[model samples]
Target: MAQSYATDLLHLIQGPPGTGKTLMLAHLAQLLAQDGLRVFVTALTHRAIHNALNKIPQVDANLPVCKIGEERLTGDLNVPNFETFDQSHFAEKSGGDVVGATPFALQSQRLANVEFDVVLFDEVSQITLPLAIMGMLAGSKYIFIGDENQLPPVTTFSETEAAQTSIFAYLAGRGQETMLNITYRLNDVLTDWPSRTFYKGELKASDEAASRRLNLSPEATRWDFVLDPDSPAVFLDLCHTNTTVRSRIEAEVVSELVLSLLMRDVAPQEIGVVVPYRAQSRLIRSLLRRILMDDEVNKKLVVDTVERMQGQEREVILVSFATASQKFAAQMADFLFQPQRLNVAVTRPRSKLILVGSHHMLKADEIVPEHKETMDMLRDLDRQLPDHHPAQRGYQRVKATRKQIANYYRLLISIMLK
Candidate 1:
């Protein structure tokens, strides 16, 4: 629409959260689809891009962009992470053509001679350096679309220090991005909450990278931040064992909870649950089935991974943080510091956020780092949840034996045994 015509080589779109970034990407992808381009579009998580693409009639009717990732979705071939993408198979299938993939996943499949007229990366901020560069290198017409204001690159301990050394550098070498100014969501005052208090918004307020971002007005005075006052919080306390629970097992939990809370005011469809990882994809599928039983429930509750739901709004979201700390839970577990992940969890729920934790641990940012500060703050914060939360909880001490009994008998029996 800008008549800016994205170069087949590389185009980067940077904007605020509510901007139609994903929509624009899908529109371009639809054009590519109509042209009979073997366009393969993918997101960092199955939940993020797949649904948006699947919703488009072009995708649903014609060239459905297959989701090729760790969790195999529709039209996707069974591929693991970047660790095992077969370059030969990619070349053979793609024929030096178009495919969309997560930056890392594209790298894993180190596709040789694979080319595209238009290659797009939606939500590029979530992409790390190595993966982004790899994908950019493979495609002649590369489009990297993401709001740097929303989330930065999520780097693991494995990645190098310099962000520029990675894919972003390659794009910058190409020179200048065409910015999208309008926001699709946040019509009037609702814009302010996300604009000012949102991730980059807060950063901007502090005068750090403030000039780069567009500021929005605040809504506290104009609109009630809480939409529904009478709406009681729907708390679905998920056990940590939720990840490992068989899909059928998880489905049963959803079913029981729905019936148990049926008399309550909230509709089954309104209830949303967000699991920890892609590993819980099966569990979500099962739970979704249970929630949809009422046919009247139009808007599906069972959802995709956390990354997809980032900055998204839902009626009520049950969150399983997916144990941040593997060992014993501590301050870092609270996830207060890591605003990206926290933002994903917090914003999903419209009225309430039902958080189920293995341990009520605090995120590092939740606690004071310095000795004197820790000594002073721990007096207040440490008192909230206990030190020996494991032992005090009683489940940790007996979980092994309890699980064994559950396997022998139905877990319902194991609950009675407990």
Candidate 2:
């Protein structure tokens, strides 16, 4: 289908989590460039642009890709930086078979006279309609690749309104998309709920991904319950004392958990700690720095907010919800319980995902009014069946609202940890 529609003016590919979207885009760009088309690649962020461009060489070692960005911002990508070349020098010396930049950067004088035959937009879900238009103008043909189920572009306005809808979502609503069905990152256990809830059960793990497990030896750790490789998803109900933006107890547990993973021979880079608030990220990072002591080891461990964790994956992802206060959770429900944020957080782990938070607080009754419908649906699903085991109740809720509950992450966690 992709080949048949390769020349379409607007092409959309809905790539769910861990589905090798970047690699697919890279290969497509390579094929287009090989066919003598001038291909331009872009995204909302420099990291995303570099991620897509870095893979082009994997397909062909000698592919000449020009990266347009400040030298410092374009991390170790093997491509030549456009900044180092004068306008005439670039046009003359480099044929510009493939060029990469952010939509904002494409407006630079360096690219004023440049045009592309094809424009590949990576992470298009994070590109607003206006930005998407800017990118579309860069070329005659376009390929948009991203997951609408993940984070949209960050905006100060209310995201619920149609004004802020991303181009990917806008086009996807019109049925102009081809869904990528298989994920290469998550295991079957890790993939289950996200597949059912977000993709209408169409998303699935590839054979290798379905059978993959963490490399850690379960017998090597005393906290095997938390470290069990066989259990891909573990929710640690750390019902700690009240807190607002940051929880010291949660930070302590995260530090200890990192220590255990390190003892089990997990590389520092293989682990990531994601938090909702900057304060919590700082607290966890400080604790990790203190425990690891070595600056080199501490630098490798990524402790960041969900916004920064997009387009990244790790062997083990530890998410700290950091607030145990129901009042605070309710007050921040619009941000905390947003389905896109939760989906990005949980899907970052390739082997295991450990979520630590106060399940009771997350299940607070005083939710944002927008999410009230999701909770009501969960209740309706609960009443449709006779009393049963806790797991069965959770399964029923998941089945009932698989497609409608956009904000069901909070209630889903509550049901799972019950």
Candidate 3:
């Protein structure tokens, strides 16, 4: 589909995470340029623009790519070529076969005279309808590449405002939409549940990906509890009240898990710690620092929220589902459980995904039938998974003493105060 030059006019590429969408964008632009067509590429942010251009080999010889923006804004890239919309040289350099910029940059008056035969929008799901239409004005045809199932554009306007839809979502029904089905980043065991739960079982793990092994040696199994064949994803059901979404016991467990991985020779760079809330991320970071103490280990591991781990991947991912409880299940069910957020969180791991949360909290009876897909997946996984918990139970639950609870509370307060 990347090399196809069909007459459909508008092309939609539904590239899920780990499908190499950025690489395809660069190669498609090269194909269009070689066909003697003027091509232009733009994304929602400068970092995305840099990411696409960085993937093109011998960028200067293969494509007449020019970065369009202010020198200060695009200076960090250190590209061989650049053009500013406000500069005098823009008129001459802008006529190149391909130009890269943001939607706002393309709105410049200097580009009013320029036109493109094809314009490619990367991450089109994040581009608002107005901004997407603004880009189409300068191009006769276009290609949109993104995952509408992921995050959408941040729009201040309501849905009542003239048909609320992102460019990618709007064209999904009207144009040719292609979904990339094979993922190269996740292992076979890691891909099955997510594919059936989130993507309607259309996604499959590539043969090469299924055969891929972790960087750790075979002896590392002693510390890697997730290596069990029956259960690649472990759910630790900890008991907690809904009063605080943050969990001290969760932090303690995650910290211990990270330390074990470190001791087992798993490089810190290969592990990622993700929490549902910012407070949990902060708390876990503090606990990890206290557990590791070494500056090098601290530099390698990542602790963040699900929102921040959108396009990132790690060999092993540990998720903290903060604020899970049965008493407040009805009140907090809708607020805490989001299908897309859960999809993003679980799919970030290549080999293993360990989720730590309250099973009762996650499987709250208050959750509407429609919104229980993620929790259902977890429940199904838990049932099929053999009892691999070290404690001889199917899952582990945190049992904190009165003093330990007090210390955990104080630690949270101290971190907040700092």
lDDT of 3 by residue, 1-418 (tens): 6433574478889887677777778778777777777777888777667777666544346566667776667644545445554353534543336677787776775464677889889878778788898888888888888887665665554322322467877888764878888888887666766677767888888988765545555454222444332345667555566635688778876776676677667789989998877888888888777666678889889998876687778988998877666556545554465555666787888776777766667556545555466456556655534343343222222333465446546654554466
Candidate 1 vs candidate 3: the TM-score winner is 3
lDDT of model number 2 = 0.75
| Best by the TM-score measure | 2
Which of the two candidates, 2 or 3, achieves a greater TM-score against the reference? 2
> Best by lDDT, which number?
2
Q: What's model 1's lDDT at 252? A: 45
Model 2 ranges with Cα > 4 A deviation = 84-90, 93-96, 162-164, 367-369, 373-418
lDDT at residue 182 of model 2 (Cα atoms): 96
Q: What is the lDDT of residue 147 in candidate 3?
A: 80
lDDT of 1 by residue, 220-286 (tens): 2111111122211222223343222123444444343333333344555665666545656566555
Q: To one decimal, what is the Cα RMSD in angstroms of model 1 from the true structure?
A: 12.5
Candidate 1: global Cα-lDDT? 0.44
Clashing pairs in 2: none
